[model samples]
Target: MNIVKSVLRATATTATALALLAGPCALPATAQTPARPAALAAAQQAKRPNVIVILVDDMGFSDIGPYGSEIPTPNLDALAANGLRFTQFYNSARCSPSRASLLTGLYPHEAGMGGLDSIVRPGLGGFQGRLADRAVTIAEVLKPAGYFTGMAGKWHVGAQHGTPPKAVGFDRSMFQKGGTYFPDQPGKGRTFVTIDGRQARLDSPEVGKGEWYASDMLVDWTVRFVDEAKVAGKPFFLYLPFTAVHFPVMAPADEIAKFKGKYMAGWDQLRRDRFERQKKTGLIAADATLPDVLPEAYDWDKLPAADKERFDTIMAVYAAAISRMDKAIGTLVADLKARGEFDNTLILFMSDNGGNAESGPDGRTGAAPWGGKYSNIFVGLNWATLQNTPFRYFKHYAEEGGIATPLIASWPAGIDAKVRGTMVREPGHLVDVMPTLAELAGAKYPARFDGHDIRPMSGRSFAGAFDGKPLTRSVPIFWEHEGNKAVRDGKWKLVAQFGAPWQLYDMSTDRTETRDLAAAHPDIAARMTQQWNDWAAKSFVDPWPNKVDGGVIKGRLEGGKAPGKGKHGKGKRKRAAQAAAGA
Candidate 1:
């Protein structure tokens, strides 16, 4: 078994490689940032524990109950209340990139996912639609180590060349390329089922053709996969990434009804309520200030009165989808508990990126028919901004709201009860997931995998944090999606919009990123900026856009507002107006 190396021990080797990065700056180690204790109990309890990673798409930082949402996610909350919560966990600000980073213990670009695959161009080293042969996935690594690796849910990593879940590493895989969550609703995506590398039919009644919800089918099949692993007496690594809460937004009518009037108060009140709950739950600092609306964002009351009911319905569908996902999770957990597998399993819950503000192309481009068809309705910017409560901006930007995500790690036999329900504020990224799981499974990441050379992992495990020990990551975390980019070094973060000037923040105090310290602390800004540029070059990050006026969101140089619209005007009325017209 190749034990995962500690961050402290890898520093010297990484320093030489990243000294200049692709340029010259060395990070100083201050008193260790908060760390997790060693999970000695879980490691020693048995040969290898079952590893399950549950990923949700387009979810905001505070959308779940454990993360301070008004949404009643009892199962998710119970897992968190009995496990660990990461206060500063981050995603890649978009879907496929985030998934790439999570699957491979390397930066997204290094894994050939510089941006969404839809727009990928040939010869673009970073935007290649497939996972590079040089990068080995966690499944690929663990499968060789006496493990049955399986995956069920969204597979957005690659399209051709066996890039599907089973092709990469899973032994028994079920997934769709990417699509709406309501399976019964007709949409533009296809669902494929594969077992032991052979195709399985989803059209059969067993898979639920007439009344299938994505979340329900996922957990149901996953339970069966676990049962197979248990019967064989082999440890399993299951990666379940759900398509819940994405868009076109559909859920069971009863579940939707439960939250029908719940959001009548409007986004402003919802943001305030969530912020208050965050403080009460110790998720954020008690004195943490709430953020003002983004320049393009508008007030809920400002929405046309005629459109109020429709918007409310959209939000209801969203909330209901969340609750439904939680219920399915509860069912999956119950199965584990019933089979006597709950105590020794390590389950992780996280989001692919922040909440989406896209109202589609024309605000109502993909409206869902009341008769149960696949819908592509964008929730628009108002409620999305509210979902990111206390943080500014939404998905597709490098701001805290776009990247921050709720991460819950639960393992009764692995994590110490004393540290359960506790918060770890150390900065971590999705790249850390692969290494962490490999460490727990005692699986070695090889230099060469599957007839090709493998890339070295750019992540460090936080297993020690489970024991309540202070930890320091070997390298700072970096992010880039579209044109939004950020580099977090210790307490300072340098963030930039596509084709915009870089803005610096002292995250130790202003995690909301309300203040720009670039001018005040030019020295820190320069050093971090150099590091960002170097990383961009090394990670295949695209060059800055030519001509400053081409970038999105102007006037951000001084303050955050878009143009004439005040921070709280809601958003450009064109989309909402179109949505109202049912265009």
Candidate 2:
């Protein structure tokens, strides 16, 4: 066995490991447990633990303290200190697609979301820009199993497509389109909050006046929903997807002040610092090597003092956003403990995608917070590189930096004591969430529901990992977004940029994907590509549209709603350099 695996296994006793691994670990198929009788389900619900899935937007693998960042995330760090952390967990690499896959146990395309909900393509089921009716959400399945489901925060999956959280199965929800953090902050689009199922005020007294923060308000409603569940005497399933750390990143002035001057060392030094910390934490393999910085990142020493100072404030704001979210999580965990639900409630925290690099190297900024044109404020490619740490690329690509997410699972009663504080090296994805919850909650996954033929889940349960056992994936994992495509089978990964030839890498040896082995291993590349193509066809993945405009293209192309003064190509770089010279 590999040293890392052996170390992980050693966390548990020989007897415990043997007994758990040898026990019956079969996950129930849809046909096997179609529906439990109402009485039986009610009785089982008493014994079932509450489940809470907390997802953050556009966060990187190393942003939180557990994943090796300087950012203060004592709440998340505390969870990992007493819980299990997966070293290799993945997301769908974007917002809508990832949300769709996470809610339903199918690929984004299979769930009728191949891209952002903002983009729609006619006659294409995959590009329908909505969550498909054929796929059932976790809330939908768990509700029938006697679980009281509630959601708070962003619900971008199918709100525009006429399927809100309440429509899908959440008993209660408080959600919006999720752009602004402060209630008074002006955004280009009007984001209205929906209470339960009806349209409601975004700036309600519940959120307060000037003190209203999105993260705080979201959790307040979550606590309210949990109170309702406790009153009903049903096991709860709560989903809290915060819009923190995404573009137009904002936090309280004092919070932002606390992080000012913390990132003055620049991206080069910060990236190295995070990489070393990640290796020391055993989050990556011992032999893993960091790749060189991308050409898009500017040299820190060469930058003007004014630009550096500005960048520092921008990063401080970014870090403040994460710190604020972490604080909110602390509040939620404390609430759970106070309610006597912390021990049994399985809290799974993760990100929707990797760090966002949408607005180019010098990210867009402006008076959007006070009511100017909505400026998409991001940390730029250089800072995003540091955020992703040892991984290459950022959000909107199939690379590790794009999809790799930090997944922390904590359940004092449900998880084995021996595995606590240990790292699970099992590679898992968002699809696995459904089956994992199903097995843990003893929920029956139905073949059909609500007069519709529901698609069978494409996920395998990773619940065995709670006992320090391997969560073996029988099939390969695949990704396709914005023309970027990739397929990973066992140790081999074949990936390609939009309109580019495939490049293969042996993931077992190089998870960072620095060296391409396509020329040396043609057979493996061909085989995996074929496998990806087959899966894509079945999953309703549409062909590349070959269209580009004022939208996200592929690779190094910088496109978003906040283009700022930076365009693409030499002109963008030239302008940035000229501005730096003036600065």
For candidate 1, give the lDDT.
Answer: 0.72
Give the distance in Å from residue 406's predicted Cα in candidate 2 to where it truly belongs. 0.6
Model 1 agreement with the true structure over 126-188: per-residue lDDT tens digits:
877778767878887666555677888877787543366655667677776454455445544
Q: Give me the candidate number with maximum lDDT.
A: 2
List residue ranges in candidate 1 displaced over 4 A.
1-45, 191-202, 360-371, 544-583
- The models' CA-based lDDT, in order, is 0.72, 0.77
Which 10-residue window in model 2 sums to the lowest lDDT?
574-583
Q: After superposition, how far is residue 424 of candidate 2 from its true place, in Å?
A: 1.3
Instruction: Give the Å shift of residue 277 in candidate 1.
Output: 0.8
Give the CA lDDT, 0 to 100, for residue 83 in model 2.
Answer: 93
